[model samples]
Target: MRASVELPATLPESLRVQLGQVLPNDPNLRRPASEAAGDGVLVRLGGHADYTTVTQKAALRACLRMPSGATLLIRMATGSGKSLIFQTATRWWREVSRDSLKPVSIVLVPTISLALDHERSSQAISGLETVRALTGDHSSEERNRVLLDFRQGNVPLLFVSPEMALGSLRESLRELSLPDQHPARPNAVRGKLAAVFIDEAHIVATWGRSFRPDLQRIPGLLRSLRAIDPEIRTVLLSATVDAETRELLRTGYVDRDGRWLEVAECMPRYEFDFVEHRFTDSISRDDEVLVLADVLPRPALLYTTEVEHAERLHQGLRRRGFERVRLFTGDTEPSERRRIVDDWRDGRVDLVIATSAFGMGIDQGDVRVVVHACLPESASRYYQEIGRAGRDGRQAFAVLCAAPDDFKLASRMAVGSTLTLDVAVERWLALLEGARRTEDDDPWSGMPQYRLDLRARGRHIANPRVGERNRVWNKSLLVQLQRYGALEIASSDDDSDGWVAVPRAGNDGLWDATTCKSFLTQIFGARAAEEERAREGIQAFKSAWRVRNDCRLRMIYHIVEAGAPELSACGRCAGCRRQQVAPPHHVATGGGGESLWPDSLSPPSATRLLELTETELARPVRWLDWLRGRGVEQIVVERRLASEIAALWSKVERDAGWVISWDLVETRSFRPMNVPTALVLSEKSGTELERLWRWGKRWNDRTHQVAWWVALRGTQIGTRSLQDEGAAGIQPPAHLPSEE
Candidate 1:
């Protein structure tokens, strides 16, 4: 008799091996995790006894088995054990290694506080030692000692900020790398290094182009490091890397042939309740604090955008008889910052009023309330800041207290001051002229000798805007120029407190007066447009703040998650809580002649239906059949949706042997039916769709159905209550795709 056995193929090879040892598998352990035995190999996790959740265990299994040169993007929500990936991967590498030839991992963080937090956390893990932080705060001797220890294989894990990792850290690695070709050779730097882990990797996209250009250099650093350590793996950890940022990282870091592991879990580990307190007048700051004092428990965090706000709040709380409150900000001395942080960690401080800088590296899991005195600049920032709370998997509150004018104030602070296109062009040309003056006489030399103080360069700007006066002029522009191959950033001069800029080789034409002006105009125009959109988005956020009939947590999730699946109403936020407390007695209605568009049939809901339609479109053979297979019933029960599915099915026909097409256009009077049409839109058809939608929904009652289609393309959307889309009446465009 011939018998065959099957085994779970997804398990990591090492874990599968261990499981096989324990279960003999009933003759079912057959498939390997990878073709190569060593590829998916996992070693026993030594001395670590905590039981991991299913999500964490799956992530760990994948990490242990991940191949060299592969990039893993882990987008688990906050408090979801993001740190465990590297922690366990380090142990696995160590256990798998022979002799003292252990693996070295570099963890790049955004702040010194985060580095220190990681260092402390790693020190607590068993079988892990020499966990050091190489930050600006370290003394020269200490930094050198850490590097020496790393070179000698005494240090296994080193944490550094993005600046140090890309600059000084890369320099140290290059200087210390052995002049050996083979990674198998003993004492070779390539053989010792295993992975480069980037914590909070989303900054690469969010801040890389602007204030923190060093973040963009991470790809270059990873490329160079991987050249030395051919098997070097890149792991990016973040709680809030949006879709755009993920695409940017993928293109920047992952090679075409390499595997980019995307392990994303947006589900919340703890229940979160969001409360928005909008002030009618600016005088409500005191009232906001008083309300918070009454509502929130002790050991809460209050986040402010400015240091002045932190100070004012701290003083107000102190006067209000809150004794354990402390203040932390950029202005705080290093020693005082450390003491305040330590006090908070040791439970000595009950309430801490701090600027945005206070929460990044903090690991206090028991923080019950996180109050934002001002609106956060972006949804991502808001999510991350509030994530500091509820780490202990308990109920937590994320409170936002904003005044009527706060939206305007936040937008100004968020967008910062920008130079007009013409002003920016003038500055670019002037900088280019300065570089020209500093160039060497030697024909081969393209480097500049002049170094101007960044502040002084800003001072030279004529009639700068209010916010631009104190801002660095070329902070972002110089980086853009460098990226465009128009210039290079020569070393930063500490004595001059500025950076030297040089023209790139074979790029002198780019600095011509006309070309320079054109480049600046184009770049600055794009920047201004992006800033304007951000301002608009902030305004929308303010409007969303006034919303009281929907779930606030779900709204936030929709904002941050972007294109991910829409989550159902959490029914736990302030809005939901209020609804629970006082159920609406009756919803107002109009007369019989008045249109009563069902809440479930709104344009937003129509967009959701279109998303489902697209999913069915993926398999066109049974496209119509799948639509009729209770797709709408899964989300909501609507007879109109069922009828719409039947109508769409009638329109679908075999275009090719395996392909199908659906005709969506109807040249008739628009009815008040919640029918969604699936169309085979092309480059030209998109315009026609827009034209038809505008024509059909031209009346004031129906603003525009086409606008809904555009809004659904990006951003996570929540299910909104049915709003009036007016009774459809007008005739559609003379030519749609079907008509054409």
Candidate 2:
């Protein structure tokens, strides 16, 4: 009784008909109720208003049939209420399987971030029972208590991160039997293994391919679960995934002969808008920074290429006096992450300058923008990140800062964790039957590699020609040969060349003979095609990066169109032509001329300032150039920014004497330079504006202008109270709600 068995009734005919429009397939209806004397139970697929949408309902019904073998994908983007769906599905399972012998559900999220978010969300949706989480980071005693509760069906919803699930399951099995025997259990080694939901399922391929070595052993784990219980239901969920990912799920999980499961596909809402901009040389770099600032100022995100840049930009913005900027990166402490999440949800921070480590699953319903300081290695990642925006169904922007070097960097990462074909073959072959053997050389059990070499040496690949290419190919061949059992040649003359695997003492009758053969043929044969597809999948991602810049849009468009769009857009995208590009210095209308940071430097933004230079803009420019030991130095010596960055400074200035030109710079000469600003927002008539110098909406500085306008209607309030007379009918600070 190791496995949890859930006996759910099939979808009703009328419900099935309605669900058919949205859910995939008619669904596996329950067999007639058992011939018990008691009354039979009735169940409905999805009872939500939005489930009326085909994809939403389909995905829900499919969840009940977890362990579907194929990876299940749910692409609702960010803020689409994925937590809502999980909540509803879990509740539905509870209702449908309560009377059954086994508890019906277990949810496995990918990261602690998602776990925390899900835990709170589940409670908001249903409070029938307390929903608890089990994390390895918890104390041993705490973990034991949680596990005890889960094993006994004391908790209806058990939310856990993937790492926690793996460790917990392993520990549970260890307590039941030895490590090796764990997988051979009758069911998941527990009588309550009803359903398991794997959140962020894409990690099974992405991150799982790297640091999480245990992920590669997941298929085996799943097998063990089934061995313990045949009726265990497993669900895989991801808000964003690609066709390659979908295929990988199919071959690696579902299509395995060890498990006979079905699959259901759900579509995504709207084709995503993907674009990139250069970061260095020319105004593109400035444009990108401004774009991010503009987009983020409207409850958006600002991204940076590196930690140094993040720190620098964060400091710079604070000094420029933007009190609403929040910085988040890998370096941010967990306590800080929680705080940042709170601010975003509460609307305190207008934007977060974060690294990729930010926002895996912190749901902020009104994210209006996602700015990438660097281009992501793949569009899959791009899609996932951009999903954070428009959670409330408002328009949003996804901007990529694609400098010349940015592409190369992203390209480098594209091949980052990829394994060469040779390496792949060798690793797989090394894990073959013979190589998995115990060594006789040692008294105690251990693996033997010499026998594998001997068998490989006799193969055709052992006889190689010349050239590096051939050498690589030969290595691949050796790897391929190990697919089957080997080691016919025993070191001693008396033994046969190949040795058969020694079965466990009592496992002689483990699997039915015919059943074993069928599984073997099905798995090995199907795996061949899967391997080929994986190779191609990797190749396609690599090729997309090489596409010409002009043609790059097509690759993006192709991916967007290929994924079914289930949600309609609210326009305002480059695709939707909401804004037009302006002439140089003329500014772009799509996003107010990217100057979001020039208004006023906040305290943190000025950390680099040495007494805040007050110099003739031209002389300071020359000194700056001199320091760069580059062209800017000569200009500084000759004097250039004298009129710009110089004027913005107050005296006590470093190199020269200058006046605080808040008003002067606001009215005169200008150029794009990276600066941070503390935007004090206001409304004039119908337009929302930020006082760059304490007053007026200057469209000349794009990012700020864009940021001001977008955030206005969204119900935003400035950090400080200003004269109410500046704008007609603008709410006074008293009427303004605090920015979250």
Candidate 3:
């Protein structure tokens, strides 16, 4: 018997038939859990220590072992200890790194409410007393004090929103990355810029493309930091990262040459009894919600898609004698948002009528009911909203009272926000025409950079608010172009008035009509694909509501979990109740049954092979000097060796160049620069090496400045093979030991 399944005697016939098709004869739904006691890590947590799960221990170990220039993706279920990963890691770093200046980490969240929630929760935890949330609610003096504490290393963990990360705090972050920055204490070296954690990372793919473009620019900020210190890490924490969201994150957040690792516990939430209803129109839906509000459960959340609708619904509920309900939306003032969250936590408010703005990382344990007054835009959103309930290991209810018009509204919202290719191109050209070349332009480099006015409008537009609308469209166009490898945005002003950018080396063809059209077509196609996926997700939710032949939980699991083999009909949903089966005993827990860092998988090696020297092999610094002296524009090495070499080169030459992977090169998604670059190769297979060699030859033929260095262990090949391809190779010292 697997940990995920416990058979109930005398199941209903409908559930029995459905479970027979999905579950194997002897199902093994979970990986073996960890047996090692987490006493060492827990003891360090002081008062916050509790019984740690296998998944939590594994994630913590992986986070602690994470090296510089690496990206880690954690996809656990909601209510699991995702926040503990950063909290513990920050404290552990401060304790281990014995120095006058301690390390600091920045956590970027999606909403101010989540930030405040974290700030409030940290008050009870040891070593996190100094954690602060910097949002618009703070006065200028308070914000400056927080920044001063951060600069002086008094604040170990800082919570902020993406808008502040790229805006007011941008210069301070850049300063932290500089290697020569003076330490606050005399004769003490400055502390390292530890890591950047993005909570609710799924938004980078969802909301980042449309309303909040700053999420997409986070990678650009990281690149700037890596240029100075190549070892700074990036950690993405989320409860749900589906296939599409995972792909977007890989291309946008993960470095082409750095390591990318994922830890997942993909168990669906099973503590909720689901019930859905469809009404003829808004009046009927309101009536049904009012009726359910009186009888369903206390401490509930009523979700709608629009702010006006949420406000109206809240007023209607209040008018009908529901005095404990409140409204929360994007337009809610910062002070009011804080009050609502505090009130909800303190048991002063029983219900919150909110849009998606109230979602993402708001942790409340006793929420018993979650009602949706309208349909969500996608399956992920719907799942996330409902996950707010049933988190206390108790039976909860999820009710959906939606109308027919929600389908059209959802479809329109999904497809209408994206700009057309024609509009994007028009905005791009307008911005270019209005752009002014910066004073630091190098004449011989052939890469002319300019600072464009984001407020520049197309000549045909004559609206009174053209400036604001044009600024938004301009930023959106820049984000799309950068994603497509057409341009590289260097930086932007806090006021959102202008940004500095340069066209990629090989992307000069973007100025040509045919080439530009073809390139923009690919970019627009990606957006269209996202919209289509969203529509499919909406349709799946609709099927779960309208089709009653199967379990509604099974339909949702197929959409959210996708390929997980664990499939059993949760006997508590409305469909099972209709078949005359009583709800079974189930307790919702936060952890999963999988071991973190499994034995079958090898963790990334921490050995620094570049430090080894032999009589026959030159020193790593000498090798870098030789390549730079020869004016080699690019160097190729294996992926595992690329990070060490990059760090060494950054230290020796004071120039941390880009590391392009074979995957990114193959997809043409990397930015091409005239400066020296390194390309990572695969050393495990001969077929892959040959393909890489052939691609390198073709690339050299076009670029005319290519160099290759292969890190060979014991294998020997003819030197003529290298000369034949106009490349160079390097072998390890004969006495060097192989990596374990």
lDDT of each: 0.55, 0.42, 0.66
Off by over 4 Å in 3: 1-36, 46-52, 180-192, 434-451, 462-465, 502-506, 511-514, 578-740
Q: List where candidate 1 sits over 4 angstroms from the true fold.
A: 1-43, 46-51, 97-102, 176-191, 209-213, 223-231, 256-259, 417-420, 423-475, 481-516, 578-740
Candidate whose lDDT is highest = 3
Q: Arrange candidates, best lDDT first.
A: 3, 1, 2
Model 1 agreement with the true structure over 474-510: per-residue lDDT tens digits: 5455655554445545444223345555566665555
Higher-scoring candidate on lDDT, 2 or 3: 3
Clash pairs for candidate 1: 562-715, 562-716
Summing lDDT over every window of 10 consecutive residues in candidate 2, give the lowest-scoring window. 33-42
Model 1 poorest ten-residue lDDT run: 30-39
Winner by TM-score: 3
Please give, for residues 293-355, the per-residue lDDT of candidate 3 as tens digits.
Answer: 665567899999999999888888888898888899999999999999999889999999999
Q: TM-scores, in order shown?
A: 0.62, 0.52, 0.72
lDDT of 1 at 408: 72
